[model samples]
Every structure is written in C-alpha cells, then in structure tokens.
Target chain A: TQLLEQSPQFLSIQEGENLTVYCNSSSVFSSLQWYRQEPGEGPVLLVTVVTGGEVKKLKRLTFQFGDARKDSSLHITAAQPGDTGLYLCAGYSGYSTLTFGKGTMLLVSP
Target chain B: DTAVSQTPKYLVTQMGNDKSIKCEQNLGHDTMYWYKQDSKKFLKIMFSYNNKELIINETVPNRFSPKSPDKAHLNLHINSLELGDSAVYFCASSLGTGLGQPQHFGDGTRLSIL
Candidate 1:
C-alpha cells in the first residue's frame, strides 16, 4: 500500500503571508495532484504534475513536483482569506488508483 | 453546466437505514470514482469504475456497494448504515484511468447517520 504523508496538518497565518505545504511518500508516483476544498464542498483540482521536477503556477499558488517523483510541495505567496481551505495532495502510482494524504487545513486571517 | 454532479447534497438518516447517493458526469469520461472524507479531513478512495466495469475496490466494508449503470454514472448504495459512515462522499471522473489525467470532482454529498 502506498502512503503519502503531509506535513503541518494545520496552518494559520495573516493575510499577505506566505506558507508552504509538503507531501512526501516512500513510494514513487507516476503523477501528483493538488486540490483545494472549501467547507461543505468537494475538492477542486488546483494542479497536476507528472514529470519529475515539474513546476506549475496558478496565480498566487505554485506547485512543485520532486525530482524523484516521491514528493511535492505547494507554496502560496501573499496568501489571502480566499486561500484559506483544505489543501490535499493525491499521488497516483503507475496504475489508476490514487493515494491521498491527510491534507492540510490553512487559515488566512484578514 | 456542471461537469460532474451528485444527487442529494445532504442525507440524514438513522442507523441501520439504507440510502443511496447518485453521481453523473457529462465530461464524456469513461472512468469514475467514489471517495470518502472523514471528520479529521482524511480522504480515501472507496471504489472506482472504468468503462462501466469495476476496476478498483478499496478495503471498504461490504455494506457499502457501488454500481455503475453506464460509463457516465456511478451510484453508491449503503446498507445498514452506521454512525461511522457519517461523512462527506465525493464523486469524481477522469478522461480515462491514469495518472496524467486530471479527475474532476462534484460537489460532495454530506451523509449524516444518527
């Protein structure tokens, strides 16, 4: 069984602050995905990184895939109230199934 | 239009009762999945269907059954619900079944068992 471990289960910061969340796994994954979920709602796909050492940026959020494909990180620059939510990292093996991390709860106070 | 949709956004019932949650995707995808999120915000994959066939079945209990009528729809039927079953259920779909494709998710269904 593949397991993805995420660091800093909970985070709280003031507006305009910067924070980074990490997802690590012992097993290598074929791809990794980042999702953000608001209260009472399902997660929305923020980004997917397939290749090793890949990086993608969406507005104030930047996602990076580790060179070994066994880890990933999500960095939010100048976080705002809108950026506060549950951040999840899902790692997919060579197959179709995805192993999800415990997820990080971010709170950006204005 | 909603790419993926789940019915009965909220379900409240007593323990030992039976209920079902329906999901549909109009993204022309052939694979769909069911995920469960616990109170601590831990998400886990329950089941997955590809091309109307069961592809992945996690360690979920037999009380929870998943059925796919077609490529575009997957429904979850839970029998003899337990208090532990109270959680948010999400439905998602991808172009096929792989890592590169991004799976789109529907607004989850919140199930509460008393």
Candidate 2:
C-alpha cells in the first residue's frame, strides 16, 4: 500500500498570514495533484505537477513537486478567509489509482 | 449546472440496513470512480469504471458493490452496513484512466450509520 503522509494536520491563522503544507511519501509518483475541499463538498483540483522540481502558481497559491517526486508542498500567501479549507495531495505512480494524503485542515480567520 | 452530481447528499441509516448512492456525470467522461473519506479526512479509492465496465476494485468488501449502468452513471450499494462504514462518499469522473487527466467531483454524500 502506498501511503502519503501530510504534515501539520491542522492550522489556524489570521488573515494575511502565509502558510505552507507538506505531503511526503517514500514511493515516487509519476504525477502529483493538489486539491482543496470545503465543508460538505468534495475536493476540487487546484493543480497537477508531472515533472520533478516543477512549480505552479494559482494567484496566491503555489504548489511545488519535489525533485524526486516523493514529496509535494502547497504554499498560500496572504491567505484570506476564502482560503480556509482542507488541502489534500494525491499522487499517481503510473497505476490505475491515486494515493491521497490525510489532508490538512486550514482555518483562516479575519 | 453541476458537472458531476450525486444523490442523497445526506444518508442516515441503521447498521443492518442497506443503502445505495447514485452518481452521474454530464461531462461525457469515459471513466468514473468512487472514493471514501473517513473521519480523519483520509480519502481512499474503492472502485473505478470505464465506459460502464469495471476496471479497478481496491480490495473493497464484497458487501460494497459498484454498478455502472452506463458510461455516465455509477452507483454504489452497501449491504449490512456497519459503524465503520460511516463516512463521506465522493463521486468523481475523468476523461480517462490516466492520472494526468483532471477529475471533476460532486458534492459528497455523507453517510451516517447508527
């Protein structure tokens, strides 16, 4: 079984604060994906990184895939209340399925 | 319009009862999947179907059965539900089985067992 470990299980910060969440695994993945899920809703894909050392930015959210494809990070700058949600990282290793991390619950207060 | 939709957003039932969750995707995708999210927010894949054909089954219990009526519809049925089966079930669809393809998800169905 492929397992993805996520750090900082829970986080709470005031508005405008910057935060970073991590996802790590011993097994290498062919691609990594970041998703955000709000309460009572399913996760929505934010970005997909297929290459190692690749970085993608969506406005204030930046996602990076590790050089070995064994880890990934999601950083949010000037996080607003809207950025509060569950952040999840999923990895695909040329298989028919994806391995998802436990997810990080972020609470941004204004 | 919701691209992917699941019925019975909230389901509460007894442990011995049986239930089913229905999912549909209007994006014309060829692949659909069912995932379970536990209380700790750990998501795991349970089943996948491509064009109404079962492709992947991740060691899920036989009590938990998945039926794909067509390419756009996938339904999950659980018999003799247990307390451990209580979780949020999400339905997702993708263009293909490739990991690179982005998946669209529906508002999950929250299943609560008593």
Candidate 3:
C-alpha cells in the first residue's frame, strides 16, 4: 500500500504570514493534485502537477511536484483569513483510485 | 449550477438500518466515484463507476453497494450500518477513468450511525 505523509497536520497563522505544507511518499506517482476544502463544502481542485520538477502558481498559492515524483508541496504567500481551509494532497498512480493524504488544516486569522 | 450534488446533506440513523445516498452530476462525465472521509479527515476511495459499469472496487465491504443506474447518477446503499460507518460520504465525477482529469466533488453526505 502506498502512503502519502503530510507534515504539519494543523496550522494557524496570522494574516500576511507565509506557510508551506509538504506531502511525501516512498512510492512514486504518475501525477499529483492539490485540493482545498472549506467548511461544509466539498474540496475544490487547486492544481494538478504531472511532471517532475513542475511548479504551478494559482494566485497566492504555489504548488510544486517533487523531482522524484514521490512528493509535493503547497506554499501560500501572504495568507489571509479567506485562505483558511483544509489543504489536501492526492497522488494518482494511473491504474487505480487516487491516494489522498491525511490533510493539513490551515487556520488563517486576521 | 451545481456540477455534482448529493442529497440528504446530513443523515442520522441507527445501527442495522439500511440507508442510501444519492449523487448526480451534470458535467456529462463518464466516470463517477464514492469516497469516505474519516474523522481524521482522510479521504479514501471506496468505489468507482464508468459509464454505468463498475470499474474499481476497493476493499469495501459487500454491505456497502454502489449502483450506477446511469452515467449521471451513482447511489450508495449501506445495509446494516455500523457505528464505524459514520463518516462523510462524497461523490465525485470525472471525464474518464484516467489520471490528470480533475474530479469534481459533491458537498458530501454526513452520515451518523447511532
């Protein structure tokens, strides 16, 4: 079984602070995806990184796929209260369902 | 418009009771999936259907059956629900059974087995 380990399961920061969450795994994946879920709502896809050493930026959120394809990271710059949510990293193996991480819950306070 | 929607946003029932959660997607996608989110917030895939055909069935129990009557609908029926079955159930739709395609998700059905 492939396991995706995420760091800093819970995070709380003041506005304008920068935070980064990491997802690591021993098994390599074909692609990686990041999702952000708000309270009482389903997760919305933030970005999908397919190649190794790939980086995609969406507004203040930047996502990077590991060089080995076994890890990924989401960096948020100048976090705001609206950026508070559960950030999830999912790895796709191409053959089966995507493997999701335990998730990192971010609470940004203004 | 809601791309994916699940009915009964909250379900409270007792053990041994049979319940069903309905899901529908208007994205005209060919694949749909059922995922369970535990208390620790770990989302796990339980089953997936593509074009009304069962393609991926994880180690989910037989008591939990997923029926895809059509491409736009997938329903999950649980028989004799247990306390451990209490979790958030999410329905997602994808373009196909491949990687790279983003899966749109429903708000999730919060099931509580008493």
Q: Which candidate leads the pack in TM-score? A: 3
TM-score of each: 0.97, 0.98, 0.99
Q: lDDT score, residue B28, model 2?
A: 97
| Residue runs of model 2 more than 4 Å from their true location after superposition | none
Error (Å) of candidate 2 at residue A36 is 0.2
Give the higher-lDDT candidate: 2 or 3. 3
How well is each residue in B1-114 modelled by candidate 3, as lDDT tens digits?
999999989999999999999999999999999999999999999999999999889899999999999999999999999999999999999999888779899999999998
Rank candidates by TM-score, best first: 3, 2, 1
lDDT of 2 by residue, A1-110 (tens): 88899989999999999999999999999999999999999999999999999999999999999999999999999999999999999998754688899999999999
Each model's TM-score for chain A is 0.98, 0.97, 0.97
Task: Evaluate model 1: give its TM-score.
Answer: 0.97
Residue B59 local lDDT, model 3: 95
- Model 3: residues >4 Å from true position, as ranges? none
**Whole-model Cα lDDT of every candidate shown, in order:** 0.93, 0.94, 0.94
Kindly provide the TM-score of model 3 when superposed on the true structure, using C-alpha atoms. 0.99
Cα lDDT of model 2 overall?
A: 0.94
Candidate with best DockQ: 1
Judged by TM-score relative to the true structure, which candidate is superior, 1 or 2?
2
